[model samples]
Target chain A: MQQNNIAIKVNGLSKNFDISESGKGFSGKLKALFHRKRKIITAVDGIDFEIKRGEFVGYVGENGAGKSTTIKMLTGILVPTSGSAEVNGIIPFKERKKNAAKIGVVFGQRTQLWWDLPVRESFDLLRVIFRVSQSDFNSQMKKLDQVLDLNSLMSMPVRKLSLGQRMRCDIAASLVHNPPVLFLDEPTIGLDVLAKESIRNFLAEINREEGTTIILTTHDMNDIEHLCKRLIILEDGKIVYDGETELLKQKFVHEKVLEVEFHDDGNVIQGIPGVTVIREQGCKKWLTFDNDNYGIGEVIGTIASRYKIKDISVNEPSVESIIRNIYNNRVTLAMPSEKSPTK
Target chain B: MESIKIYIMLFTTSIKARMEYKVSFLFYIFAILSFYAGQFGLLFILLNRFHEIKGWSMGEMVFLYSLQAFAFGFTNLIFSQLVNFDKMIVDGEFDRVLVRPLSPLGQVIFSKFEVSTAAHLIIGFTALYFGSRYANIEWTFYKIILFPVIIMGGVMIAGGIRLMVTAVAFWTLRNRSLVHTVIFSSKEFINYPINIYNVGMQFFLTFIFPIAFINFYPAHFFLDRSGSGLLHPSLEMGTPIVGIIVITVSIFSWKAGVNHYQSTGS
Candidate 1:
C-alpha cells in the first residue's frame, strides 16, 4: 500500500493523566479532600505507527496498557497530551466534529442505544443524529440484517438483550452511518464461541467488501488470531512489537520440543549433533532444538537411526505461548523502523 | 433547524418511554401537584393570619411564588439533562456523546424530556389568574406584553444557573448536590420578596446569581411598588437583559467546560 493511502497515522502520540493519590477509609478520604496528593501517569507513552486503508489491525495489550486510551484519542473522545494523530487526513481532536462524521466507535462494556427505547427506535434516532439519507439508511439496515441477524432483534429493548445479542446490535448501531473507519474496543470481550466467530466473520466481510479500515482492541487471543492480519502489541504504555501476526510467532517461537519413547527400558539416548537431550525417564527421552537450524525431520531421523523408537511426537509453539514468553522474558525485541517492512 | 427536529424527536421518544409505566407516571404528576399545593396552602394560612406582609397582600405573594414556579418548571423541563450530567460523566456515557455528530450541549439539553414538572405550570397559571382577581392591579399594554417576556427571562436565568453549576462537573466529576443546592436554595430564598431579606443577601440574589431579577424585580416593577430601598428601583426593568446575559455567559462557561473535559474510562 502507498504511504499516502494510510488511513490512520500516529506521530509520537501520548496522553498523561494527573491521578490523585488518596488514603484509605472515610477519614482518609476526608484528608484527601483537604490535601490531594497528585501524581502524573503516562498512559500512552509516545507511540507511533501507521495503518493502511482496508487493513485489519488488532491492537492488543493487557489491562491498563493504554489500548483504550489510544483508541479514545484517535476517535476524538480524548485529547493527547503531546504529539499528533490523524484519521483519514483530519486531526481528530482539532476537527472532532468533522472527524466524528467520518468514523464510528463502539465500546464493548457500554451501549450507545437508549436503554428504554426499542432497537428499531434507537436506530431511527441514530439516523437523525447521523443525518443518514432514507435510502442509504434502509440499504445499510438491510445489509446489517443479513449478517447481524438484526431482523429478530429489531423490536427488543436493548436492556432485555443478552450480552451476545447486545454486542451484535451495538456493532450494527455504529455502522449505521457507514463510516469509512471503525474502532472496536474489545468488541468480543464476553461473547461465546459461536457469537465470537459470527462477529469475526462479519468484521472480515465489512473490511473486505466495503474496505472499512478497522482498528480492533481485544483481549481474546482467538479474535486477534482469526480477524487481524496485522498486530500491534503494547506493554506498559509502549509499543513493544508491531508486525504481521504470523511473523511474530515465527520470529519469537524459534525452538520446538520432541518427545520419544523406546521399547527397551535399558536404552539411553545421547546428545545428537543439533539436539539437546534435556530429559530422560525409564523409556522416554525429551529433546529440544532450534527448528530453523535443525529440521524436525532430521532430528527424528537421527533419533530413529540411533535408538529403537516406539513413539515420537513434535510440539510446535502456539501464538499464545509466544506472547506469554514475551511477557515473562520482557525482551525488548528490535522493532522495524518507520518506512521499513519487517519482512 | 435540524438539531431542533432531533430534539423534538428525542423528546417524543422520552415521553413515550416514560409513559410506558402508566400508573407511575400519573401517580408522579398527582403526587407532585399535591405536594406543591400543600405548601401553597400553608403559605396562604400564614398570610391569612398576618393579613399582609410589609404592605404586600396574600395575592401579591401568590403572584411572586407562582411566577417563579412557572419559570422553574419550564427550566427544569427543558434542561433536566444538565441535572444528571455528572452521573453521565461518571458512567462514561459522555464519551459516547463526543463520538456523535451532534453538539454535546445540544444532545445533553434534549437527552431527557420531563413531564412531571409541568405540574408547576398548572399551579402557576392558576395562581396568576386567581391572584389577578383579588390583587386588582390595573392592566396595561406594557404589563400584558412584558409578563411572558419576564417569565421567559426567569426560565433563562434558571437554565443559566443549571448550566454553570453542572459545567463544574467537567473538572470535579461530581456536582449533583452542589447543583441541587444552588437551584433549590435559590428557589427557597426567592419564595418571599427580595426586599424581605437584608442588604447583603438582596445584593447577592440580585446581582451575584441574578435569581431575583427573574421574578422579584420584574414583579416589583410591574406591581408599582418601591421595594425596601437597597438600590435604584429601575434595575428591575432590566430583567430581560439580565436573562440574556446570564444565558450567554452560561453558554460560554459550558464551552470552556467542554474543552476542559477529560472523559472517564470505558
Candidate 2:
C-alpha cells in the first residue's frame, strides 16, 4: 500500500482521565465524595499512525495500554484531548454522524442488536437505520451468509444465542451499511477454536474480496498472526513497535527450542555452548538456543556427533511467546527482511 | 415522518412484549385501578365531611384533582423513560442512540411506551367530564375545542419538567430520586387551588416551575370562574403557550446533554 493511499490517519491523539480509586465500602464511598485529592491518568499519550486502504492491521497492547481509547477515537465515540484523526476524509469527532455512516465498529463485550428482538428483526431495524436499499440489503445479507454462515442463527433471539453465534450476527449488523472501514476491538475474545476459525476466515474474506480496511485490536496472538499483515504494538500509552507482522515476530523472537530424545535411558548431553537446558527427563531434554548465535544445523550436528540421538525436533518460538518477550523487555531481536511477501 | 412511524412501531412492540405475560399484565391493570380508586375514595370522603372548603365546592375540587391527574397520566404514558433515564445512561445504552442517524433524544423518548398508564388517563378523563357536568359549566363548542389543546399543553409542561430533570443525569449518573422530588413537588402544588397560596408562592409556581399553567389556568377558563378574582381571560388562553416554549427549551437542553455524555468503558 502506498503512503498516500491512507484511508485512516491519526496524529498526536491523547486522552486523559481523572480516575478515583476509592476502596469498596460505605465509608470508602463517603470518603470518595469528600476526597479533595485527584489523580490524573493519561490513557492515550500522543499516539500517531496511519492505515492504508484495504490493509489488515493488528493493534496489540497490554491491559490499560490505550488500545480501546485509540479505537474509540477512530470510531468517533470519544473526542481526543489533543491531536486529530480523520476516517474516510472526515474528522471523526466533528463529523461524527457522517463518519459513522462510513465506518463499522464492534466491541467484543457489547452487542448493538436489540436484546429482545430476534436476529432477523434486528437486521431489519439496522437496514432502516442505515437506509440500505432493498437490493443492496439482499446482496449484503447473501454475502454475509456465505462468509459468516448466519442462516441458522437468524430466527433466534439475540439473548438466547451463544457467544460465537451472537458475535457473527453482531459483525453482520455492523456491516449492514457496507462501510468501507471496520474496527474490531477484541472480536475473537472468549471464543472457542471452531468459532475463532470461522471469524478469522470471515474477516480475511471480507478484507480480500470487498477491500474493507480493518483495524483489529486483540489479545489473541493467533488472531494477529492469521489476520493482520501489518501490526502495531502499544505499551504504556505509546506505540512501542509498528511494522509488518513477520517483522514483529523476527525482531522480538531470537530463540528456538530443540526437543531431543536419546536412545539410552542414562544418556546425558551437557556442555553445549549457546544453549540452555530448560527441562530434562530420563531420556528426553528441552534446550533453547539463540538462533542468531548458532545455526540449527550446526547445533544438531554437534549434538548428534556427541550422543546417540533417537530424534531431534526444532521449534520456532510461538507468536505468543514473542509478544510476551517484547512486553517483558528481555531482549530485542533483529528486524526481519522487508522483502518478505504478503500472504 | 419516518420518526413518527418508528415511534408507532416501538410503542406496538413494547405493548406486545408487555402482554406476553398474561398474568402480570392483568395484575398490573388491577393494581393501578385499586391504587387510584383508593385515593379517589379518600378525596370523596373528605369533601363529603367538609361540604365545602374555602368556598370551593366538592365538584370543583374534583375538577382540579381530575385535571392534574389527567395531565400526569398522559405524561407518564409517553415519557416514562425519562423517569428511568439514569439507568439507561449508566448502562451505556445511550451510546447506541448517539451513534444512530436520528437524534438521540428522539430515540430515547420513543424507546419504551407505558401503555398501562393509559388506564389512569382514561379514569382521569371520565372523572373530569362528570365533574364538569356536576359543576354546571355552560357547554360551548369553543370549550370542547380548547379541551384537547389544554390537555396536550399540560402533557408538554409535565414532560418538559421531566426532560429537564433527566438532563441532570448526564452529569450526575444516579439521581432518579432527585427527579422524583422535582416531579412530585410540582404535582402536590397543583393538586390544591393556586389561590390558597400567597402571592409570592403563586408567582414561583407560575414563573419558576410553571405548574400552574398546566391545569389551574386552563381549568379556570373552562369553568368560567376567575382564579380567586385574579384570572384574566387573555392570560388564561396564553398560559399553554408558555408551556410550548418550556418544552422547546427542554428539547434543546436534552441535545446539550447528549453531547456531554462520556461513555463508560468495557
Candidate 3:
C-alpha cells in the first residue's frame, strides 16, 4: 500500500471545532444555564493534494487561515474530524508514534530544546527519545554544524540564547534524528533579515543535498521567493492556488512601471497596444504594461521611434504587493498569454 | 521496559533541572515539613483539649492523618503533573508530548517528578513513629506486612483522584479552581476517622469517591474496632481492589477526555 515517490498524500482532509456561544453578564449566564448555545467552525475544509519525494513546497496563508490547523493534523498533534492523510505511507493520526519517528517539526514560536538545560543536553535527550545511534548522532551533529555553526552554541543554556541563535539550535535539534520528512511552521518568523537569509539558504541546501522533503508554511514572501519552487496558497480554509512559484510571479506580478523622460516638451507620445500612461508630469510619463502580453522593449521601441530621444527605466512590481493584490482580489491568476518573457 | 527506562531518564532530567535552583528546592522541603508539623501541633492541641472523640484517642487520629499524608505525598511526588495538567494544556505543551515517539500519558505523568515532596515521607514516617507509641499498637507479622500494601494502595487512590481531576481539563481547559477544590476537599475529609461523620456522609466518602478506603476504613480494620455496621470492617481487604478499580475508571475517563480534546489557538 506504500508508494515510493509520494512523500505525502492528503485526500479530502478536514477538521471542525465546536465552540460554545455564551452570553455575557450574570443574568445572561443564569438564563443560559437552561439553553447552552454552540457553533461549529470548519477550520480546515476538505482539501486534496499530493507532494512528491524531495519536494520543497511552501504553504502560505494569512492568520486564521487554517495553515496551522492543517499542519497539526499532519503532525498528529490534532486528530482530523473527517477524511484522511498519509505521510511517508503511514496514516499520521493512526500510527502517530511510528510516523513521529520519521518526521521532524519546528515551531518558530517555540523551541524544542529543554528550557533549563544546555543545548548539548537537549540534543542528547532527543537522541535517546528518537533512539539515534551514537555514531549516527555524531555524524548528524557534524552535518548540522556545517550549516548551523552550532559548535559555539552547544554549551549555552537555551533560555540564555538569543532568539535567532535559539532558532538555529532548534532547527538543528529537529534534524538530529535524521527524519526523512520535515514540517516547518513559520521557521523564519520574527527574525532579522540576515538571520532569515541564513535559514533560507540552509533550508535550500538541505533540500538539495539531502533530498529531504520539506513542507513550509510562512507569511514572508521573500522566503517563498527564494526557497519554494512550488506553492500551495490557502484562503478561507481552502486551496486558492497551487502551481509553480514562478508562475504566480509571472502571471499576477507581471505589471512593470516604465518611466520615460523626453528631451523636448513638445513631443507627446501616444499609447501603444499594451502600455497605458498612468502618470504624466511635464515631459516625463510613467506607463504601466503587462509584460506577459507585450514585451517592455517592444513598447519602448515604438515610443522611441515616434518621439524624441528620452531616458527610460522599468521597475517590476515587488512580489509582496502582487501577493497582497491576489489575497485581496481572491481570484486565481489566469494566464492570458503563453509567450515567455521577452527582453 | 524501554518506556520505563525513558521514564527514569526523564525523571532524572527533571531532578537535574530542579537542582539548578538549590536554595529554593531546600526551602520548599523545609517549608512543607514545617507546615505539616504545624498542622500536627494544631491537631494535638485540639485532641488534648477535647480528651476523646467517639472513643478514639489522639494517637489513633495522628495515625490516620500521617497515613493519608504519606500516601498523598508519594503520589504527589511521582504524578504531580496530573494535578497540574491544566497548565500544560493551557500552555500547549500537551501538543508537544503528542509529537514525541512515546505514549502521551507516560510522557506527561513522568515529565514532572517532584523530588521536593520527599518531605512528605519524612513527616509521615515521623508522625507514625511517634503516633504508634501513643496508640500502643502491637508489632505483629501481619500488621508489618500489610502496612506497605496499605500505603501503596492509598497512594494509587490519591493518584486516581488526581487523574480524575486532570480529565476535567479536557472539557474546561483551565479549571484550576475546580481541581484544587476537589483535591483539597477530599484531602481534608480523609484526615479524620470516618466514624466521626454521620452515616450518609460515611457512605458518600466510601462509595462515591472512595476516599474512606484510603485510610479511614483501613484504620478501623487495623485498630480492631467494629465499624458502625453500615459497612463491614472486612471490606478493608478490598482496599487494593478499590485502588485498582478507581485507577481503571480514571484511566478510561482520561482516555475519553484525550479523544475529546481540541487543542487551543495556534
Candidate 4:
C-alpha cells in the first residue's frame, strides 16, 4: 500500500544515455554518420530515497554527480533505464501529463515561460494550460506578487527582464498552478548573493507555509545551508550522504579552528592545553581542537593565559567546509535508517 | 476545446513577438512576396519561350505551382519549428514541454509560428485565381467543393513529410541535413506535372516519396485532364487518403522518437 504522506519515492532509479561516437574533423564526422559506434553512459546509478510531505531537501553533488539526472527522472523529462519512481503516487514516465499537473518544475538555466511574451500573459496561458480556476489563479498570483515582488515586472516581455527578474518570474510562474511538489535544478546558479538570498527565502517560505515538498539541486553551499532542512549528497551517480543538514555536518566535521593575533610580531606561542597550534605566520596563530573534548572558553583561556592575544575569534566548521571534507574524504556515510553511523 | 483556446492564445502571442520589429518584419514580408512573384515571372518567360512542356500549357503549370505553393506554405507556417527540433532537445525546450500538463506535440506546435509564410499564402491565392482564368477551367459545384478539401489534404501531406524528418532528430540530435534535403528540396518535385519526368523518376515521386500527392496528382482533377497517360487513373483522387495515412504514420514515428529521447546534459 502506498502511503498518503509520501510526496516522492524512488527505488533503484537509474538512467543510461547512449552517446554517439564524436569524430574529430570533417571526414571523421562523415565516417561517424555511417559507422554508428555508440557508448553508453550511466547518468544516474541505482538510488533509493523517500521524501515526506513538506520536506525541504537539498540534492548536492559535483558537476557530474547525477543531481540533475535524478531531478529529471522525477519530473518525467527523462525515462529511467531501470527501477521505479513515483511522484504524488503516479508513475511520472507512464502518466507524464497526470504527474505534470500535480507538480511544478523550474530549470534555472532555462525559462519555462514563453521568452518573448509578457509575464502576465505567460502566467495566464500557464493557468489555462494547468486548468487553474480563475479564483485560484487570482489568489496564487496575488501571493506570488507579495512574495516575489512581481507587480513591476508583469508588463515587460520576459526577454527584457534582467536575469534576476527573470529568475524571480520563473519561480512565481512555477507556483501559479499551486502544485504540492516543486523540483528545482540548479535554480540558484549564476545569481548574485542578494538575488540568491531572495530566491532562498521565497523557497523556504513556500516550503514552510504552503507545506510544499521541494527538492532543490545546486552547487551553491549557501543555498543548501539556508534553505534545506535535509541534505542528500551524490558522488559519481551514487548517494554518499543522506540525513539532516545539521547531522551531516556533525558526523563529518568535529574539529573547530580558532585564530589569534598577538600584539608583538613573530609570536608563535606553544604549550597550550586542549588546543594544538595548526598554523603560525607572522604574529597571527591558528589553533584546532575537538569540539566534543573541550569547551570553547576552555580552549580560549588556555591560549590567552600563555600569550598576550590582541584579537581572538572562534570558527565553527561551516556547512561548505564540512561538505568539502565529505567530498574530499570520499566518506561512505551509512544510511541512517539502516544502521547508526560509526567513525 | 481548451487546447484550442490555448493554441489561439499562443498564436496571438507569436504575432505580438513578430510585431516587435515592425519595420524589419514588413521588409521581410515584402522581400518574400517579390521573390515569389519574380520566380513566377521567370517561369512565365520560360514557358513563353518553350510554349509547353509535355503538352501541358503555361496556365496549367502556373496552377500546379500555385497549389503546391499554398500547401507548402501552410505546412511551413505550421511546422517550420520542427526544423529546430535539435535545438529543443539540446536547449531544454523539450524538457520544459514534457513537464507541462499538455500534449508534447501540441506544445511544440504552439510554441512558434512562421508568420512570414503569409507571403507565400497571398501569392498562391492570387496566382491560383489568375491561373484558373487563363486555363479556362470551369468550376462546377463538385469541383469547387473539392478544391478546399484538396488543398487541406495537400497541406497534411507536406506537414507529415516535415514531421518525419523532424522525428529523425530525436536519435540523431540534429536534422539540418534531413530538413534541407527531405522537407525542403523534395518539395521541388511537384512544381510541374509528374508526367513530365521519366517513368522511373515519376514512380519515385509518386510512390516512393509521394510528394506528388501534395500537388500534381490532385491538380489533374481541377484541370479536367484525363488519366489515360498516367500510371493509374484512381491516383488523381488519392490526396485525402494519402494525407490521412502519411500524417498518421508520421505522428506515430514522432511519438516513438519521444519515447527514445535522451535529453542533453545540464
- Using Cα atoms with residue i matched to residue i, what is each candidate's TM-score against the true structure? 0.91, 0.89, 0.91, 0.92
lDDT of 4 by residue, A39-123 (tens): 9988889999999999999999888889888988898888899999999999998988999999989999999877877898889
Fraction of true interface contacts that also occur in model 4: 0.74
What DockQ does predicted model 1 obtain? 0.66
Tens-place lDDT per residue, model 1, B113-193, is 666676767778777775666666667999989888998989999999889999999878999899989977779888777
lDDT by residue for model 4 (B54-137), tens: 878888877888888889889989997787878888776799899988889887887778876887787688668866987878
Candidate 4: list runs displaced more than 4 Å.
Answer: A25-31, A269-281, A292-298, A330-343, B228-230
Q: Write candidate 3's Cα lDDT for B1-266 as tens digits.
A: 87788777887887777777899889977887788677667556644765566787778777777778788889878788777888888888787887889888889888887664676787687778766777877767898899888888888888888888889999889888887888766788877677788888888888887888888877776676676424776787667888898888899998878777788786
Candidate 1 residue pairs in clash (backbone atoms < 3 Å):
none
- Chain B, candidate 1: TM? 0.92
Q: Whose DockQ is greatest here?
A: 4
RMSD of each: 3.4, 3.6, 3.1, 2.9
In terms of lDDT, the poorest run of 10 residues in model 2 chain B is B42-51
Of 2 and 3, the candidate ahead on lDDT is: 3
Tens digit of lDDT per residue, candidate 2, span B1-266?
Answer: 87677666655655655665689889988887887787667556645664565666667777777777878888988888888889888887776665665656767777777666777776687668766866777769998888888888888899998998899888677888999899866698877778778888888888888888887788778888764624565688755797798899998887676656666774
Per-residue accuracy of model 2 over A1-343 as CA lDDT, tens digit each: 3544888998999988666566569888788788834678888999889889999999998998999888887877677888988888888777777888888888888898877667887888778767788899999999999889889999888889999999999999999999999999999989999999999999999999999999999999999999999989888888988898987666655678999998886766678888888888888988888777677888999889988899989886777787888788764434443443321
The native-contact fractions of the candidates, in order shown, are: 0.60, 0.25, 0.58, 0.74
Best model per TM-score: 4
Model 2 residue B77 CA deviation in Å: 2.2
lDDT tens string, model 3, A1-343? 3488999999999999888767799888877666778899998999899999899999988887899999989988888999889999999888889989999999888788889888988899889888898999999999999899999999898899988999999899889888889999999989999899889989999999999999999989889888988999888788887888887767666578988898877765565788788888888888898777777678888988888756888876666667787788843455434565554
Any runs in candidate 3 off by more than 4 Å, and if so which? A24-35, A251-254, A259-270, A277-286, A303-319, A333-343, B21-30
TM-score of predicted chain B, candidate 4: 0.92
| Counted clashes in each candidate structure | 0, 0, 0, 0
Per-residue lDDT of B52 in model 4: 74
